[model samples]
Target: MSLPIVIIGSGFAAYQLVKTLRRQDTQQAITVITASCGDDYAKPDLSHVFTKGQSANDLIKMSADEFAKTYDITLLRRSRVESIDARQKTLRCNGESIAYQQLILATGAKALVPPFQGDAMGRIITLNGLEDYAASEVELKKAQSVLVIGAGLIGTEIAMDLASADKRVILTDRAEALLPSLLPDFVSAQLYQSLGNQGVSIELGTQVESLRQAEESIAISLENGHDYRVDAVVCAVGLRPNIRLAAEAGLKTNRGIVVDRQLRTSDPHIFALGDCAEIDGNVLAFLQPILMSANALAKTLLGQASNVALPPMMVKVKTPRLPMQLSGNTANADANWQVSASREGMTAKAFDEEQQLIGFVVTGSHMKQGFSLLRELPPTF
Candidate 1:
């Protein structure tokens, strides 16, 4: 029998590759090594579960057993891939050596644990996967008020979801505004105000200096000399790619596991994708790019040479209070943004010196207009 194509990690990247590969060639022997229960769930839904009326279990599209049975894959749940032996084409997992024809690293990113002086640091939680969410669900349900650190995309979205679920949410960041790196001031102001309208308190321009246990609640001290006591704390700072295994294997790595356009790593037999993989110097962690990479890699694995080619995909900010979608550099844009606002929504377009649309942002009811704007925007990947 031929050696199976073994994939490390069972996140969206790995599962998507299996799905894409099976769509064309179902008979290929595939094996998945996952750290968790191997339940297939959308990571993006982690923040929106409250607002979307979903529990952690509800987020799972399929269980590991079901998925493996459906796709004819050898699913190893609750398993970890400790080391990769590129030269020998083997993996040291659970004190066992497993061989593979081709290996793919889909080990996703992990939540960034913010550095702070805190005795109660253990009380703060960071959600990055189904397991994290499942573990935090009980604490979230018991808490009335929550302190959410960071005001970036994930932070802001989780804050809104918490607020919408009737939890008193304090959204804070070291930056002056929410998503300061992703939106213009005017647009951010709109979102800031909208979040306020949704009953979320915004504390910007400062980070948590310390966190202390206050009886049953958590005491949070901000660098701005402000303090608050909340029933729970969630740190939604950001994510750092998982590159330790790949790096230990002697594969090239920078911000993430460096791979070529073909999703091939330094070792020709090893490939990578999703949050852990950086292609062409870009670490694309978004769903669209991950799916594209999976499709391209699927073709490549099937002996069809293909490169990851991404379209201008706009990301929808899941804040129901003031919906928004954007692509390209809205913040620090090379050109000035042509701004327009109204009762329906606001739309900002940025044009280069050549007078071509390079980037854009839309909010409120102007989401439908994003189609045309996205078409005009320059290639991002």
Candidate 2:
């Protein structure tokens, strides 16, 4: 009897990796272990909650049984990988062990809950996985007014979803603008105004002071000493990659699990992808990057030693109300940019001193230019 190839997650990264590997070698004895139910689903659908009119149950695209039967792969549903013995190449789980010809860590990231006090016992939710979403959905049903803490992509999306649901939504952030890391000030202002038109309250340049459980609801204390009452609170603050496991195993880690172009970690037999990995200091938290990483890693698993090179990845922020297509490494580029705005949408272009297009943000229907700009962008090595 031979050991199976073990994968430690079922998110976009792990799912794509398994799907690609199965296509190349169906008899590879693959086993997927997930902390969640191992249900197959597009995680990004969580943000499209309002537009899709989906409940927590309806949001799930596929079940574990469906995936297992469809792929003829073994699914260890709702199992936790306690730790990995990298030197011995084994993963331990509940008095049992699994050996792998190769192991991939797609463990993903956890939402960072700020150090604050309040009815901190689950009244406040973070949308990181199915379980978290399920819990949040229940609270959302009872919430007439919702408080969202953060103005980043996830936070803004959730705020829009809640507002679309007719829930009075209040959003706050430490940055002066929404999606500070992804969009320019003017573009963010455009989105802020758009959300306002949709009846969302914005609180930029503010932070959460504390949270307190009021009668039959919660009160969110703001840094400016202002308190707002809301039926539910969602901490869409941000995410930090789950690298403790990899770090504990003596594998080299930086912002994420540092991987080579082949998606191989410091240990040759171990590989990482998704939010938990930082390939050449690039931890892409988008769908396109995840798909690319999966494809590249799958080739390596099938005995092809190929390096994965990425083009400037484009992301559409599912704000159907705002309609935008944004792209490039907007988060890390230290360069000047040009902004063009009209009734159509705003186009913000970042260029290097050498006059190379590095990043861009296109809002509303005017984002059609993204395809043309994407073709002209350089390879993200």
RMSD, each candidate, Å? 1.1, 1.8
- Give the Å error, residue 236, model 2: 1.0
List candidate 2 segments past 4 Å from native. Answer: 329-340
Clashing pairs in 2: none
lDDT of 1 by residue, 246-322 (tens): 99999999999999999999999999989999977888888999998899999999899998888888888888888
Error of 2 at 335 (Å): 4.8
Best by lDDT: 1
Best by TM-score: 1
Evaluate all candidate structures by whole-model CA lDDT and list the values in order.
0.89, 0.84
The clash numbers for all candidates, in the given order, read 0, 0
Model 1 stretches astray by more than 4 angstroms: none
What TM-score does candidate 2 reach?
0.95
lDDT of 2 at 187: 70
